[model samples]
Target chain A: MAESRHLGDIILKIDHISLSFGGIKALVDISFQVRRGEFLAIIGPNGAGKSSMLNVINGVYHPQTGTVTYKGETRHHMPPHRAAELGIGRTFQNIALFKGMTVLDNIKTGRSLKIKPNFLMNAIWFGPARREELEHRRKVEEIIDFLRLEDIRRTPVGMLPYGLQKRVELGRALAAEPDLLLLDEPMAGMNIEEKQAMCRFALDVNDEFGTTVVLIEHDMGVVMDISDRVVVLDYGRKIADGTPDEVRQNPEVIKAYLGVGH
Target chain B: MIYRETGQYKSNYGADEQIFPIRQDRIGVMIILALAYLVVPFIGNDYWFSAILIPFLVLSLAAIGLNLLTGYAGQLSLGSAGFMAVGAFAAYNFMLRIEGMPFLLGFILAGLSAAAVGIVFGLPSLRVKGFYLAAATLASQFFIEWVLTKFPWFTNYSASGVITAQKMVLFGYAFDTPVSRYVLTLVIVTLLALVAKNLVRTRTGRDWMAIRDMDVAAEVIGIPMLKTKLLAFAISSFYLGVAGALWAYCYLGTVEPQAFELTRSFQLLFIIIIGGMGTIVGAFFGAAFIVFFPIFLNLFTSTVFAGQLDPGMLSHLEQFVFGSLIIFFLIVEPLGLARLWQLGKQKLRLWPFPH
Candidate 1:
């Protein structure tokens, strides 16, 4: 697994993108390139527009300027579902699992694009629809097993602990079989043990699936430990971008973290 | 004890994903189907057929329709009766205009017509939600009623705008008697209900539910909001249309625009609320409650009072009691009757064990 973990050509290129809400700028001319099969971390203080950057990547937000090139196709604006169809899947900062549904069903929902729907076939639950449902169920069960959520397979996601819910959200994104996985503070509110488990899962996802991962985190230790590259954002602009060691040595990033007046 | 699934094991995902995955549930459903098809026809009388069963089944279908939209898809609609009226009138026109058109074919056509209207009305849901969306749908109810009443063509130039439904003829067989009508309703309702059950478990159903639970997350996750919302409206109206056709042909034998009024839409809404939103069985439970509760109240009141209370006052008393009970049930179980049923089954499965 370690030998196979090699970064290839650039998969996602964010051009000089600028985004604003009325008068408040969320992102200002922020640019970055994510190589194929690499774990990239975006770190920032509160309101640093980390989540907004993820949103832009997944097409939840359209920047006023610049294009997102994914798998060689560049687009100024893409719908969220179209982005998902193009193999970009994301989890929210807040746990966004379908609360009413069981864990199994929630994961299965990630496979929405995979299932070619036939209304009549689905209504009857026969032939191709039935077979497809079984097939997807198998895949979802595998995800459940992979995430060690077998005990809670039938449990409603709302009933789970915050850490477990975040894990399940990751499981849901993984179920989508995405080429690019975007995680927004997945370890937020988790204990040290849960954080370690989450980090392990993230590493496994990158190593085994060879999927490109973009993570937003505030934990400096976790970021320095896991990420191949780190992009530090302060006040809607990229301050530093390099390997974790190089980013740590950069005075600009230290000033952003340690504060200007202090 | 009877609901136990201790020994039953699903070897595959296919077995596990069944609508009734538990053996006991499968058996229970089979028994219910057997009773409905084999036993009910022989035992039920004309009053039972017309007054209770037929309306209950039809309304259950309509409730299921509304449940799919409001309950599953989270789109509040106030135009269910209007869609039903479309079905009733469309069926009427199909039978009248076409030479020798089959009743089943006419019903399907009526459903399609209602579906079209439902789509048009459902457009507003894309922009608004909650009370605003409900208000938007109310326009469909008033507008549909106005169109049906304003035009003499819908009523075939009838002065009162009341359209007597054409004879329900199949492939050379007429469903004339109460038992026959009841059977027809039971079959259609059961089929549609099963179809509904299947739908709610499939990907389509999950997408609707995802939208309902959280639209922003749902959209971000790639569930197309426009297509999903519109499909919910169209399918919901299709079911409502069929139910309306059944109401005209089998239950009432005649329907005017007044019959499918705003009050009727409220009744349908009440059924889903009382029965349990988002559950197919909840629709049936709600329909049964709505249909039988009043009659039960009347029976209890009349027998207990024995003409001591005036009929007019007694009816008012019944309404008071009914309203209170509805509020009580809602307060007791906001998830509705289906949840109660689920809890009961859960308790039964763990009988005599504290854990």
Candidate 2:
């Protein structure tokens, strides 16, 4: 296969996005641009609207204030399915693998957006549908190989250990073949070894696929290491947005991480 | 060792995706089916055919329907009996209203009618889940039974709200005899169950399981929740509807509205729970347990404990034992007897090695 081209030329621009839950504001006038193929990290403390930002990008929770423009197209309150169709894939902050399903099946669920054949063809188990299924299965097998989950691919996700389950979740999201991937706390519950393995996989995904990634993480070290740019969120507002070195030295981000100066 | 899969390797997708991936399982199923079709007809007695086999087969089909909704889809329903009632009544109506309608067609049409009603009740599932959704299905149970009983039209204005079956002939073969009725029910149930098994392997089935696991994630992944869930209800009700027709036409030879009450739904639910939720074979296990346990208890009470206990006490004891068994099964192994069987097989596969 030809080397995939860099996605950095594309831009995901969030323009003055504001989302409110009932009467309270969850995100207020937040705006940021994520260049394609860039590993962007959103860092914030508890209740800093980090998850809400990811949710807005994936069309989970639509913003009330401003439109989101992706690839120069203005998108206002599109459904999650449309977002998925538009090449946006995301993993939940809390692991959300289909527990009763095998790791393979859960990954196959990610391919749902791409499959076009109707139920009749599927029910009869022949023709175009069966061929499509086999094609997808090959792709899923490749993913399983990439993730080194060959042994556990047939095991139900619920039975897997938490760290492996997290990997399976990533595998599922990757199955969508999205242009932009949103990962919410990929290293949340992992130990040092698992975290390193995850960081390596995440980097490989970006390098190999040239896919743009936006991650929400609390680990500043991991963020500084992998992220091309870091966005700091505080109280539903953008506090700082710059290169890792620039954001680390910024007084506002320092104060947000550690309490204000004595 | 006959069940071992050693030396069998799947080299392609077709081999890997076969319904019975293990060659032994495939052979075993074929052998059992051969026995059922070829041998059982000649050797099986009349009493076994009429009292045990026929009712068991019908109830098993009903259990399979309930399992699809409650077990696989995680949609708790208390309206199995109501859907079955719709099938029986609809079949009856089709027979009475349409001139020269075949019995088989009437049963199929009855199932379709029940599916229509099941979809209507399934609408509430979109807004609710768990116990609340279960309560909503109760509305279906009550409403269907009430309508069937109160409305004179359903029973053809029969004096007692009872619908009796006329002699049902399929291609001039009368299903009046126990053997013929058993064969008909067996054929229909086996075919439908096979369809149900295949249905669960399709995208629709996966979509339902995804919804059961997490609706939000399923929807986010682009599964149309409404379509998948409603299809489950429709298909499940269709099965129950067919089973209902069989119960009335083949088993009872007549049916009343009271035949499909809330208690019947509860019985079906219990069967799925104790048999193993989500496994097709579990439906049969559950049905057999539910259908035979009472009869076994009655016989044991009348014969073995005849001198030791009074008849009234034995009846009460039977109820207590049944209730206790359900509670015991739920508490000890919520996965039910199916899991136990699986565990036994696993141990056999790995004999002499500690798991």
Residues B127-152, candidate 2: write the lDDT tens digits. 99999999999999999999999999
Question: lDDT winner among the candidates?
Answer: 1
lDDT (Cα, tens digit) per residue for candidate 1, span A193-213: 999999999998988898999
For B128-229, candidate 1 gives per-residue lDDT tens digits of 999999999999999999999998999999988889989887877899999999999999999999999999999889999999887877887788899999
Count the clashes in each prediction.
0, 0
- Pull out the clashing pairs in model 2: none
Off by over 4 Å in 2: A1-7, B352-355
lDDT of each: 0.92, 0.88
RMSD values, in order shown: 1.2, 2.4
Model 2 Cα displacement at A182 (Å)?
A: 0.7
